[model samples]
Target chain A: MQTVQTIITDLKDKPGALLPILHAVQNSLGYVPPEIVPTIAKALNLSRAEVHGVISFYHYFRDHAPGKKTVRICRAESCLAMGGKALESQIKTKLGIDYHETTEDGNYSLEAVYCLGNCACSPAIQIDNDVYGRVTAESFNEILTEQSA
Target chain B: MSITVYVPCDSSAVSLGANRVANAITQEAEKRGVEINVVRNGSRGMYWLEPMVEVATDNGRIAYGAVKTGDVASLFDANFLNGGTHALNLGLTEEIPYLKKQQRLTFARVGITDPVSVEDYVAHDGYRGLKNALSYSQAEIVKHVSDSGLRGRGGAAFPTGIKWNTVLNTPSEQKYIICNADEGDSGTFSDRMIMEGDPLVLIEGMTIAGLAVGATQGYIYLRIEYPHALEILNAAIANATAANYLGENIQGSGKTFHLEVRQGAGAYVCGEETALMESLEGKRGLVRFKPPLPAISGLFGKPTVVNNVISLASVPVILDKGGEFYRDFGMGRSRGTLPLQLAGNLKHAGLVELAFGATLREVLYDFGGGSATGKPIRAVQVGGPLGSYLPESQFDTPLDYEAFAAIWAVLGHGGIVAFDETVDMAQMAKYSMEFCVEESCGKCTPCRIGSTRGYEVMDEIVNKRDLDKNIPLLRSLCDTMLNGSLCAMGGMTPYPVLSALNHFPEDFGIKAA
Candidate 1:
């Protein structure tokens, strides 16, 4: 396994390498582990506070591992105009988990994203690497069920 | 002879099942023993017609849209390969009124070419600007841009020429050109469109900037939400590099320019130049105070030219067509076309690239066909989230910088998000402050603390607690944040809050005072 330290080593040569390193760590490990903060700080020659600050400042970086599936729902004005509020409620009800919560079964994790630049096809959602647009409550349920299966 | 079919590789198009539609078409063609050339093109900016497939016919390319996988077989059955009519048929693509009326200067080849094909890009006058630029002195190139009257498309409306001139004049051992692709605004996607559609234009634009400014290195600070764009951009970069359009000694000009794409973590504040630079440095995205402008000292304390994607992408055209050609399009000091993004409740939500001075009424009614919900549009928030919410009474306001300013509003980033009468202005006001709180860099007290206080006050007003007191408090807090904030993130947060309060007082449960 390529450890977080090794990932940091590969990216350390670049300018302003911390964000990329953190992104790499998250991509590889599913989240930036608290245990590796000190390691990253020492490797980058920055304070642990600095590393932690960078990690926490961006909403994309997660401190903990997500569930089997991570779903990001667009919460920006475009989505809001297209009944995104209803869709959010429906998703929460379906998974029994609110934003930033993982399902008890460890099958799903939900997060709110500002915009996905798919405003034309409003009420967009991203599940892992795939983005879906013009999502409805029924369609969302179908997508979740299909992904879970 | 194999018939050519065009399908969008645009991220938003893909999100709407353009990928699946493309796959189904290919599979259907193979199964039917028909030869077809499926070319992945970029979106036409008519997103409502997405998954919009085009067929090259003698009458010009014909379009079929809102396609589904199940419709693919039937499409072939109807002889769609030869521009056959079907239920989804939209006739000739260019003849479509929504796209035909608007001027497409910057996005001339966007949806018209294979984005990764350097040959196809060049065929459509892609490298002409770079070729023209190679012949000119750096000052001449800057002069041409200045004469074009191009302003920054990224909401600020700063003269593109003046900024380039400053960077050209600023002597530095290490100068940088940073293309701010961190388009975090909600209603805009033109940046993403241009990047994914005709990436070579942006590369050519950046290369021109490098040659003009004597910079050898450039970075595109792309937003994290655009994974699809990132993939397309990286591939395009590699293709350009392989073709010697990028890297050292580009096209035998003896000039060296290297370009790299850096991903931004999800932070709206990073769209601001100073904060973007700070974030690019691998630090917290904190907004820096002005004294040493980015043109003088930026990107590792070296003189850097930071421009928005649209601003940079528009350069190739300006260079190719001469500055006066572009300058002839618009009205007043706000010259050149504005690629206005019509989104939210608009019936025909898409990109409308037109010369400046198109009224809000023309955009909303003529181009957009009014609200999608068929209800009366209560408000339209122009220039992204920070822009003011305009009522119908203000619809006659021309989409000019000064015209918008005259109305106490801004034409920031050219994004117009419409909201129907059902929208609650109080809730929108609350979300504005809440978004500020969430995305604020915490560098200044006004934005950091004021946003939270504003949200609380809006909450109280919505909840009908201390309406008389909290209303005045919110206004005062907005004033302080507007005056004391370090950047536009704090300063412009008041635009939405106050506009909502002023325009639609009924939604806030208050009588129009």
Candidate 2:
């Protein structure tokens, strides 16, 4: 298996390469493990503090491994005006987990994102890599059930 | 002749099942042995009509919209290829009143042509600006942009030509042109649309900026949220490079320019130029105090021209047509068209590229067809999350920058998110403060600590705990955040909070005292 250090080394030479390296690491390793920060810092020739700061600053970068599936719901004003809060409540009730929590079954992780830029459709959600808009409570449940099944 | 069919590959369209609709149409066409050319065009900005399928007809392109996979077979059966009549048919795409009435200077070819095809882009008069730009000296190019009265469309409303002249005058061996595509603003998708629908225009615009400022290196700072745009832009860049529109020695001008796309780690503050530069340098996204403006000293401590996607995308037309012709549109200081995004609970939520001075009521009613829920529109948040929430009484305000400023509201990024009567203004106000607390970079105290305090005070007011005291306290905190913050993220957050409090006092459980 290619180590996270190898990934960092390949991308380190490029200009403004840290974010891409972190994204690549998370993409390959599922999450950016805390132990690899020093290696990334070394590869990019920066302090571990700087590397860690970048990781913690952005909401998208994850430090820990996610569940089998990730569900990101839009919590911006457009979605909020379109019943996103109620949809969020419904998800919490159904999954028995709050925002940023994974289901006990190891099947799902719920996250609150600011905006997915689908305000025209409103009430947008992304399950894994696929985005869905105009999502309702019934449709949300159906999607989750299908993914679990 | 093979029928030409267009289905948008725009992310918003894809999110609403444009991809599925495309797939269904393709598969069904194959099944029926029908000869058709499926062109993946960018969105027309009329998002309500998406998965808007356009068929090329002699009478002009006929549009069928809100198409689903299930409807594809029926569409094929109804002979939609011949502009067949159907429940979803909306006649000729150009004749659609929502689209016909507005001026689309920046987004002229957005939904009309295939985004990735350089040939298609050029056919629609795409790279004429860069071609025209190569013939002129850097000073002339700067003069043209300056005379056009073009300002940064990314909310600040700074003159684009002045910014270009600063970079042009600054003696830097290595200057940069950075296109800010962070677009963290809610209810705004014009940037994403331009990037996805007509990426070449953005590329061409950036190229023009490179030539105009004598800058050889450019970077487009994109947000991580826009995965689709990232793909389209990368592909378009490679295509433009291969075609010699990008990279060194463009059209044998002996001038060199290289462009790259850098992904931003989901920070709203990164939308600010200084913060964007910091993030681009692979550092923590923190706003730097300005004295050395980005145009004078920016991006690796060199002169840089940082512009929003719309501002940069609007450049090609300004170059192709004379700057004076482009300047002829709109009223006052706000010269040129603004791509207004009609979102939220509007019945016909979409993109409307109109000149300045169109009344907000016309946008909400004529183009948007009012609230989607058929309820009265109690409030509309013009601009993004940080924009002020205007009451129904303020709906007639003109869309000009100065007009909005006169009423203490900003036409930031021209994003209008309407809300029906069911919206709770107090809750919305609290969310603004809470949003500030969550997204604050912690560089300034007024934004970091003040926002949290504001959130707490809002909670007290909303929960009806010491309403009179907390309301006044909230106002004072908003004032501090408004005056003392380092950037707009902190400074403008009070726009939404105070606007909500002042406009909808009843929702906050306050009877004007």
Retained true contacts (fraction), each candidate: 0.78, 0.75
The stretch of ten residues in a row with the least summed lDDT in candidate 1 chain A is: A1-10
Which residue runs does candidate 2 get wrong by more than 4 Å? A145-149
The sequence of per-residue lDDT tens digits that candidate 1 reaches over residues B1-513 is 999999999988988889889999999999999999999999999988999999999889999998988899899999999988899999999999999999999999999999999989988888999999999999999999999999999999999999999999999989999999999999889999999999998999999999999999999999999998999999999999999999989999899999999999999999999999999999999999897999999999999999999999999999999999999999989999999999999899999999998999999999999999999998999988899999999999999999999988999988899999999999999999999999999999999999999999999989988888988999999999999999999999999999999988887888998
What is the per-residue lDDT of model 2 for residues A1-149, given as tens digits with 9 covering 90 to 100? 36786787689988878998998988888889998898888878899999999999988888999998888889999998888899889878988999889999888899988888899989999887677888898988877776678
lDDT value for model 2: 0.91
TM-score of every prediction relative to native: 0.99, 0.98
DockQ of 2: 0.79
Provide backbone clash counts, one per model: 1, 0
Interface RMSD list for the candidates: 0.9, 1.0
Docking class of 2: medium
